[model samples]
Target: MAAGTGGRGRRWVTAASPVLLPVASAGLVLTLWWGAVVAFDIPRILLPGPAEVVSELIRLRHRLWEQGLVTLTETVVGFGITTVAGLLLGSAIAASRIVDQATTPWLVAFNAVPKVALAPMLVVWLNLGMQPRIAMVVLVSFFPVVLATSAGLRSTPVELVELARSWDASRWRTFAKVRFPYALPQIFMGLKIAMPLALIGAVVGEFAGGNTGLAFVIRTASAGGNTALAFAAIVVLSLMGIGLFYAVVALERLLLPWVRAVTA
Candidate 1:
């Protein structure tokens, strides 16, 4: 009886841990921040209290929402392109040794390039528009998805391939049935990494002074020394990242119920 109760307790703890830990950590951070603001009587110009940030967020919610949507749109557009292209390139690499060898050097070199430095060039190449921002998102995010997909596809067991061959399954048939399923989990892992990256890329493009999105709002607020408002914009960006990350997670759960059940 005691063992059974302990098992149930462990299960409950495991089930609750994800949500509880983050909430607790955020609460603790906010408490410390509020305490520091009061104890130091910190200048609002340098740092704003949590309350002030919240108030500013509320005051600017509409404008923030509009800007946020722009960021989200660019992020999604760019990320979608990244995912599709990554899957194609990854499949090619995984399927062909020659293709992998040929592409590796270029992929490594491109990945090594500091994407922030490309913002000005991207703007110059694409002109001063969301096109550059979306391109920025793709550049920053494409590598992970490609690497993950290639790894996952290549990781399919040799025995599975042999068995498929014995059964007279074509290469496409085997990949569709066996390889793709195995790759889904890793692809989603890449996606989680890519999603936040896409958002950051959008902001980076905006920092080049394109005049839209939360990045633009943040730049304006900071230039005017509205630290509270700037902090508020940052808060919105964090929420956006959190929201996007969880959305991908939820989609993963929905699509891969067996993966979730196995992991749990």
Candidate 2:
């Protein structure tokens, strides 16, 4: 009975650790931040204390919500576009040597260029609208999906391919049964990477030129020397990024329960 109880307790702890650990770590960080601000007499302009930032968050909650929605919409839309385009392109490259040879160099070269440099150009071409922001997100987030998908598809075991062929499976059947499943882990990895990149891309576009978004809030607040408000905006962005990342992780676990079991 005692052993069973102990086992259940351990399982409970394990289950709760994901939530508890982050909360504990955040508490510790906030405590340290508060202590440092109090000890050093840091000016609010230089570094607002956690309390001040929280207060600012409360003050601007509604505005922040609206801006956050705009940013989130841009990120989701852009990531959706990236996922579709990247998968199609990656699959083509992986399946055809001609496509791979023709496109790989260009992809490498384009990815090498700083995305920040492209943001202004997008704004110039598309104007200071949501189109440029979405475009920036696509440009920033598309490469990882393509890279991961192609690599994963290409890395499907030779034996598996042969086994599928031996069974007289059609090309599509083989891919659906074997290659795509094997590639899902990598594809999801690309998606996880792209989610944050999409958020960053939206922010970069906003910084380059925009009157909305959390990034815009941060930019305007900092420019106006409302350091606490800027910090508040940053906090909101951090929360948004964390939420999106975990959503991807949850989807991955849902689709690839076996992967999680193996890793665990």
> Runs in model 1 with CA error above 4 Å?
1-16
lDDT of 1 by residue, 1-264 (tens): 999999999999999999999999999999999999999999989999999999999998899999999989999999999999999999999999999999978999999999999999999999987999999999999999999999999999899989999999999999999898988999999999999998899999989858888999999999999999989888888999999999999999999989967885
Deviation from native of the Cα of residue 186 in model 1, angstroms: 1.4
RMSD of 1: 2.1
lDDT per residue as tens, model 2, 46-154:
9999999999999999999999999999999999999999999999999999999999999999999999998889999999879999999999999999999999999
Top candidate when judged by lDDT against the true structure: 2
Compute the lDDT for candidate 2: 0.95
Q: What is the C-alpha lDDT of each candidate?
A: 0.93, 0.95
lDDT of 2 at 60: 90
